[model samples]
Target chain A: MNKQSLVYTVIFTFIVSFVFVTLLALANDGTKERVQLNQELNRQRAILNALNIDYNGPQDVQDKFQNVEQIERDGVTLYRTTVDGETIYAKEFTGSGLWGLIRGYLAVTANMDRTIGIEILSHNETPGLGGRIDEPWFKQQLRNEKIVDGTIRVDGAGDGDTNHDNGQIDAITGASRTSDAMRTILSRELSTFQQILGGNS
Target chain B: MSSPGQILKENLWTNNPIFMQVLGICSALAVTNLLTNTMIMTIGVTFVTAMSNLTVSLLKGLIPRKVRMIVQTLIIAFYVIIVDILLRAYLPDISRALGPYVGLIITNCIIMGRAEAFAQSNPPLISMWDGATSGFGYMAVLLVIAFFRELLGFGTLFGIQVLPDAFVPWTIMVTAPSAFFFLGIIIWIGKSIMNREGAPA
Candidate 1:
């Protein structure tokens, strides 16, 4: 009942802290497996979506992902899928954006000469501006575009003259930094992919 | 002391958190761009507020005067983490969609306000009701704003196309600035209605 007593405050604080921490630890333990599974599933789904593969649910994802093989070639992780006797590859890309790291999947054709598709997995870009990079319209620009000499250009100037044959894409209007970041990421990742796949092909 | 029904009515309409008290507008503006995100955020906020209120009320008798705020904050944070974990485990898609906003629920003023003003003095059951009704009030306003934003911005409600093909989506409504105008208009309309109802006959 002594509101001013230091002992009471200390004891109360300790008890509350102890109880809540224990509760959180227990909840975290309970959800650990499920959370990890969900995260893994999400990553797989992003990879599949980037490859333009159709999947409906977790079961479908697993079934379709069965065709994809994960390989660590020259310290770079690549996902390879063979459909109708042609191989397609996807690799995770992480690069600096305007605010933080932008992570995504880059799917390349069998010869590593063209991009099959691109899917942004996560980014800390400012919403509504740089964040528009995650929108389908922006990503669609990277789909089926040729990757020339392990480089891609993002046209920052509002010129609609981006050459698809030369691996050039238009940047989101208000997200020049993010677009530039994406360009840097794709260039860097393409070199890595070429190195990993160079000896095999 | 007010009756339980009066408390519910007061929180839901007369003293609504968003339109009346304006207690938690941060999440409102951030997540109301999409109806789905708003709904998920509303549920998460409601869970944290109700559970935190109940926990705070139960411990009110033993809480010291100087440390009550700290204790309340601990409870709120604990519940918020639980919500985050559960969402990651069971509703990973929504969890990822919400990003850091779920964690931000711990800092929402409405939960702390209820804990200090109502839960610290009321019974656990009543405090829970008050917390839940406050959340519901906040959610109602957010959903209304989201309805207009998503409908006009994305030309969809709950991700379904309701607007005709001839309708052009408003680009501004998909951004945070759009929520400001929508929320302001709703607050204006809500206040005029409340004022009329409160006027002398």
Candidate 2:
């Protein structure tokens, strides 16, 4: 009965921890299914975004995704979508950022020479710095750019030219490392995708 | 002994956790770039603080003094994990937007500070109210900062474009340093108001 006694302390700790852990376990169990669904939905949405498709909600995402064919070739899962008899391919990519992993969907045109668009699914880069990669302005630069000779050149901010014609996109002002990493990841992954697509590029 | 109303006022204004006491500033700075993010973070912190405080106060009588801190931390962490799970399950978009900041709520000082200073001695109801009010106070300050940040930095409020098309966004306001300035100015203004009302600055 003594509050200061070791037995009482041990019992109190055990009871408190047991109660909370049980509550947490119940909560985790309750939300596990929905959480998985949400993740799947986000992945689908990202793929849709990379294809430059307009989607409203979960139903829209599902309906749009229905038109896309999933093909796994050489350890890479490619999402192929056909619109007006023209085909587009999107592949998931993960690469090291300045702080952590940067993940996204990279979609290219039927010829595999020009990009359709890119949608960053998730990233752990520094917010407001490297994180700006997810911003419309930054990602817009990559869209419709030509991947020349299997390489994409990224120019630093304030350089002589900020044009995307030569496959160069301007880097974020304070996130040069992340910009460089993104460029490298795109080039490397693009080459890999080209090989998987029978060296079309 | 203070009444519940008094406790609420003290924590919410006179001894505000963010502006007046300046206890928890890390998350305030990190997530205040967007009003939606700040709102989600505020709700999460409030839930954790109030629940942890209530739990700690209920067990205050039986807790061994030597292990009180460890017990408090465990309780806070337990509640935080529950919040994280719920967010991931129900509000996947906000959860993903928050990233690890939700998990980092365990390290937020306001929760631990209230548990140690108020919850350890107060009744459960009072402790819960105190914790919730403290969190609300923190939220109020952060929302003010986020208003300016989102407005000027992104030309949006709660992701809605409220600014006119001619408005130019301030890129600096989107970064972390802008939060520092905004928070500093807010604290200064709050202190000045308090001093004018004959309270210690």
Candidate 3:
């Protein structure tokens, strides 16, 4: 009955793993619905913000989102809504950031000529530096931004306040690498977005 | 066995994980830009540390010597996943803000270090107390670091602007390297104070 015996070791490891993992599974099951609901709300919120739709809170976000239609085609999901007689298409995008993957919603007009806005759903960038991508000012810059030369530029150099023009946005100070990553992410996503939605135009 | 007060004092000052052993600095830096994020992340770490310690202590007698590390790891990971699920469900925004850092708790050495150093030898309840105090020690330093980073970098505390409109933020304060400066200063102050008390930890 030695605790160090190989047979005991194998049985002990299996039991311990089973117990801990089962506990985790139970916790996961208990919260799965709530988590999924949170995710759905968050996604809806991001789409709303990117399209410059105002929502008060959770209930309002849910209410406002009802008008928006969900479209799944060409292996992608797009949220379609009309704002002020303008047809807007919003889609979730995943791209590389400075530290890890950055996921967000990119909303553009029907003609795909201008951005309705963009809201970062999640990112692993430094909280104060690169993470500023989610701040009011940064996302504001993307609102009604003009997409030039078939891409949006996230590399404005401390430019004087020229938001929504020249197709350039300022890189967050002290976060140039992350800014560069955003530039790449935006341009690439914009192209893919065009390819996916272009046929409809 | 050390009294609860002694354990608390030792962990908070003399044997602080951040200031003394300097463990768990990566998360300390990553989540410290904002006080709220720091608070939540630290609390999550505290919960993980305490629960894992209690479980490890309870299981120590039965754990196989050759597989102890893996068992301890599974225990830690189990708790981390639960924390993550709870955050995602109940506090979705904060969960998104935290990003992968919650999952990264599995890699934080403080949990494993406590399991091997204190939990393996201590009784279950006190070992849990020891782990919780160790987390508080880590939390104390991180909160201090977050205070300075958020204030100087954003001219705000907890998202409320305290600095005037004319005040310019120290951009570096919001970046990763700035964490090193703040953490070092805190550690230096802590050590000097400890030395003055005729006890250098």
Candidate 4:
């Protein structure tokens, strides 16, 4: 607490803080670009996954992504990522789940009757239970699932093997709430998209 | 000079932040569900921690003792915000994938603890090394947990096909609770090693 001690402490503190902040600024400069690029590509990939548009290379993916334009139909925003002048995929989205938000994209065929794929863009819920919605197995169920006749099915069930037009996808075990949430969100979004498409036509 | 072996021993075994002091548990539990995400997060935490420690150590002298904590928080927040922006702009997918967890890194006790405990006392050079080492310690534990999660839970590594098609995922390993269990075991193993090495038990 003496004057000399105080000055020493003050000087030491000043030097330390200055050096720390300066070094941080420098390090930040180094890794900034790589982190940013990685994140952007990840998002684009998710968007593509939502659209079910496959690509062999980054350039091919980017080109396909560019062709697909995002359109807002009614209240839902759909990301349309196309390839070869045809509407390869359309993403209809909605959110719901236990204890947090779950945002899902239903990737539908151009005609909108069948699902090419689906992906969860974001979700926050109980980690073990509600969060399993992002698993690939859970996600895979939506692939090739149809949206016909107002009802969705999983495992190609209840249609006597002839119900190709019926929408269905297998639900993850113990994730019933999350599965139901996805179903509800997708159904609502698709219904809205149908209405919007109707209005536009 | 201290041998590189000593540094490795210290970081990988003794003085581990996650297993020993149990710092950064919030993120440890969150991202450990996926090896790829865990690796990305670990690297992010490592960069932030090492740079922040170096910065704090450098400024340890000038910062008024009364305001030192606030100063540290400000510096940490600034780096985190920068990280968040970079993630948003560049690694939009992982950024989106990481969701709130990235921002939550600001609150991770491990980063703040190192800035206060080690950085405030050490020289910048040593502080940088310590920070990086400790961050790796945290990463090491989480990655082990994530390895199990991705392997058993998803039957993959870094999203690559690892398990044969005949393999069925455990399903439970990919959740947050699994992280908790694995982290507990890691902490136990780390502490036992430290104790066996004659470090303070």
Show pairs that collide, candidate 3.
none
**Model 4 segments more than 4 A misplaced:** A1-52, A65-91, A107-119, A125-144, A153-164, A197-201, B1-11, B194-199
Best by lDDT: 3
Instruction: Please tell me which model should have the higher TM-score, number 1 or number 3.
Output: 1
C-alpha lDDT score of every prediction, in listed order: 0.87, 0.87, 0.88, 0.72
TM-score: model 1 vs. ground truth: 0.92
TM-score of each: 0.92, 0.92, 0.87, 0.75
* lDDT (Cα, tens digit) per residue for candidate 2, span B69-89: 999999999989988998898
Q: Can you tell me the DockQ of model 1?
A: 0.65
Determine the iRMS, in angstroms, of model 4: 6.2
lDDT of 1 by residue, A90-194 (tens): 999889999999898999876777888889999988776788888777777777788876777877544243355778788777778888898788888888878
lDDT of 2 by residue, A1-201 (tens): 788888888888888889878988888888888988999999999999998889888999999999989998787789998866778899999999988889999998767777778899888887667888888888888777887887677776842233556877787787889988888898887887778875542
Q: If ranked by DockQ, best first, what sequence of candidates would result?
A: 3, 2, 1, 4
Prediction 4: B-chain TM-score: 0.91
Between candidates 1 and 2, which one is better according to DockQ?
2
Error of 3 at A58 (Å): 1.6
TM-score of B chain for each model? 0.96, 0.98, 0.98, 0.91
lDDT of 1: 0.87
Q: Compared with the true structure, what per-residue lDDT tens digits does model 4 show for residues A86-153?
A: 46446546576866777656666566666667777678765545666676666766666777764465
Which candidate, 1 or 4, has the higher lDDT?
Answer: 1
Worst lDDT 10-window in candidate 3 chain A = A154-163
Name model 3 segments beyond 4 Å from true: A71-78, A94-102, A111-114, A124-127, A146-156, A159-201
lDDT minimum window of 10 residues, candidate 2 chain A: A156-165
